[model samples]
Target: MKKTTLLILLLFSLKSIGQQSKLKITIDERIETLYSVAFFNDYFLINNHENLYKNTLKNKLNILKNHKAVQLFDSLSTKYNFSYYRTVEWILQYSNFPEFNKTKNKADDYSTVSENKQFLLEEFKDELIKFNQDTLFQKYLKAVKPLNAKIISQVQNSTTIDELPSYLEEYYGKKLNSYNLILSPLLHAGGFNSEIINENGEKEVYALLGPNGEIDFVPYFDKDFIETDLILHEFGHSFVNPLMVKYENHVESLSSKYFTKELEKNGTNQGYSEWKYIFNELLLRATTIQITRQKFGNEKAEKLLNFEKSVGFELVENIVEILKEYELNRHKYVTFDEFYPILIERMK
Candidate 1:
């Protein structure tokens, strides 16, 4: 073909690709929460100071006014749902997600490069030692040691996963024969994976109960740590699914009706201040749960012993960037597959 004709054809092909491309922008939901309300609620939960609830309304509104989302949402507050947490994801625009097709370029999946845990643990001892020196970790270790002893003691007598069924039935007083789950959480080197469910949900958590009705521990322990406390937290959701389902309906029954009415208010307040209040509240209420733990108790010694707060403050700084990125990419549906790297980048 002539050079001029070839150039024309190439231009047309490029134009066609752009025309057919699904890279068009779309509107994010118009509804959103004002910082004033979310921040106030967070403050009350965190400090347990009833006076925080009675703060001047003007002071509360000023807290999160700097936040861009707070401003945008405040302008469109009329379109919001009952709560921002429940209804932030107001729309789903279905399209082909961005695929890297990086099978050839991607690193190989983690594998058993070593023969066993004894060798792997030894090899990674330096990294392990670093985590071991945590001042706050003494209590965590004390709690885990007894649990580890229980498993080790059971290993000699309770040989199989089937044996766990009877052991659990006697210990827990529940017939779990029908509810079976197998967990092998290979912390050092294992593929974190899934369970049988009605649909493919990335966030689903399930466990296997043996014939006698307990965690099928022995079978999976050689392969992984099945009884990690984080696992129990996931199972708790399912355990109280019925009660959690009705919590919204009767929330006022368990609490003062006046307070409930205040929480439902919305005003465009400063976003950062609002988030600080809410985030601090979460930190306070998040239980350590060895037996029973309370944060910032009336005890003077407890109040004096405090985290530097620098670490958490830094974490919040990076999370704000993450929130901004999410807002900017609502049209593109861009997302970070892993937030850890950004966290490290900001911290270190």
Candidate 2:
């Protein structure tokens, strides 16, 4: 009886270890509110998809077109070079409306909020609450609830979503405490990710993805879009960006040597102006290619590699080759970070 009990307990432990966590896919009211304000303030005016807020919600929320929050955002955008993704990052630090306090720190101690902006947000807290209350944001959320439910249901059923955590954890040799996929109807074509170190010192990652369009009054995600762009690429940033910070000097030196004017121009056009940003993006894209190859197949991976190169990431193929070496020598390297310097040296 004792021997049989031990065997059953050991099998249960192995089964538990084998089970990977699925992504938590839902619409966040805080993100929706922030983007709604941004949309009315003309923040998404440039390079965003035509399908942004084109559904029934657009006309219903027009009363907030001139809200104080919108005015403040407009003025701030004019005064500073506040990129769309930067704005999203700033908003992610704050708690949900009515309080709007900065409750979350950026993961890995990278501060995205300027001290001046921080102070301004603290001062503007009441007005933000007023904006939320007066504009009937809860009512807007209620209207969006069913659409949110539909998208969540669709995403929960995705095989790619189910497979992502295991693939990423195995690749990085690090486990995230949680994964969240937040759907934003107002975000359009842009996808953003936030890595937050929670109060418990656990890493929580969020993939903020936009809707492609509404189908029969419900927001829809293109299967290919979710699998490749939103899932692999965006979440890959969480793993890659923090690791690159330690090698910033090496990246800058490499950029000086190889990041040509044309490459800088291409990178700047895609919102990656700095050497570190471009380097981090190259690493992330390369890793995404490698993960795709492992998860899907070589043909799909080759197609993605070609697409990335066409879009100005010319060095991605080389990075992918380096990543291949890392994969084969996991006994020597252990983690991708351990093999990063080899990548830096080979890039030269």
CA lDDT of every candidate: 0.27, 0.74
Candidate 2: tens digits of C-alpha lDDT, residues 1-348: 999999999999999877755677778777777667777777753224444244444677777777787777676666654555666666666788677777776665544446667655554455566767764666877766776777788877766777787888898877777788888877766588877766676777888888666666556787766776567888888777767778888878897777888888888977888888988988888888888888888887888889888888888888898888899999999888788889889888
User: Which 10 successive residues of model 1 have the least lDDT summed?
Assistant: 23-32
lDDT by residue (1-348, candidate 1, tens digit) is: 699999999999999976542211111111101122233334211222222212432243344334443333332332332232221211111111122111211112222222343343232223222323333323333433443444434432322333333322322223321332322111111111122222222222233211111243322233112222222222322322323233433422323422222222211121113322333222111211110112113342122112212223223233334434433453543222222233223323
Model 1 C-alpha lDDT versus the unseen true structure: 0.27
Q: Between which residue pairs do clashes occur in model 2?
A: none
TM values, all candidates: 0.20, 0.87
The Cα RMSD of model 2 versus the native structure comes to 3.4
lDDT measured at residue 202 in model 1 versus the true structure, 0 to 100:
25
Candidate 1 to truth, TM: 0.20
User: What value does the lDDT take at residue 222 in candidate 2?
Assistant: 76
